[model samples]
Target: MLKKDKERNDAFLAIGNIANSVKSAIAPYLDGVLIYVREGLSVQSRKRGSVNPVFDCISRLAVAVGQTLSKYMEALLDPIFACDLTPKLTQALVDMGFYIPPVKPTIQERLLDMLSMVLCGEPFKPLGAPQPNTLNSVPIIPKDAKDP
Candidate 1:
């Protein structure tokens, strides 16, 4: 059990590291966007509010960040699903009753669902509970669900 715990911890750390790395990579882009917005706002104020350049820049930056993070998250999900450590983690969660049956999804399914939830900025509700209002705009069903 000790060894299993260590493996689970390692896997969790690996996933966290990947998320941190992606965030770190985007930090410079975020900083540049902020600087541009600030400059634009200052210029607009000097020009007596005749221009709204800051909002445009902010919107573009937000879109770029969303796209980048979406790609990163999609890429991250596959490996996480395939990792040997995941099933063990899921089993442990189940054993502790953190994951309820009837609605118990496979490891891969759970991982994909989690990634989608995070990307959509939704709270991580377990499978059986009511999904939060934040997910109203995003589709929560699995892609494969439509087929079978």
Candidate 2:
């Protein structure tokens, strides 16, 4: 049996962190994860609508893939939308020292703000790739030249 919700949440997070590190490895497994997501969300749907950690893992995976998730939208969108997020969003703002706005912004605004934040980050700098040793490279001499 799956563990309690808290335990399942931690497991979901671990899988999501793996997704963040190796997204290419996640595509083939998307269907499986979607199954869990749908099931988890459905369970949450039957509750009093407390924020669920399955949603957190979904966010993590979405961030890892960006728009690549579009292809799976048909399977994902409904259960996601079926769950109410206002409480979670309000809690997030409160935690961040924000006052809830008089009117909730549309979902597009929230999504755009998230995308903007990501796009505004400092550009990624690659860890330097392997380098061939240069100090040990001897100069090649032309057959006709006395000096290398």
Please provide, for model 2 over 1-148, each residue's C-alpha lDDT reduced to its tens digit, 9 standing for 90 to 100.
Answer: 1547566667676767887788656867877886776776675433723335666666666656554555665565556555545554334233222221221243334444444556765333335945556866867756866657
- lDDT (Cα) of model 2: 0.56
Please list the residue runs of candidate 2 whose C-alpha ends up more than 4 Å from where it truly belongs after superposition. Answer: 1-3, 44-51, 87-148
Clashing pairs for model 2 are: none
Colliding pairs, model 1: none
* lDDT, candidates in the order shown: 0.39, 0.56
Angstrom error of the Cα, residue 25, model 2: value is 2.2
Best by lDDT: 2
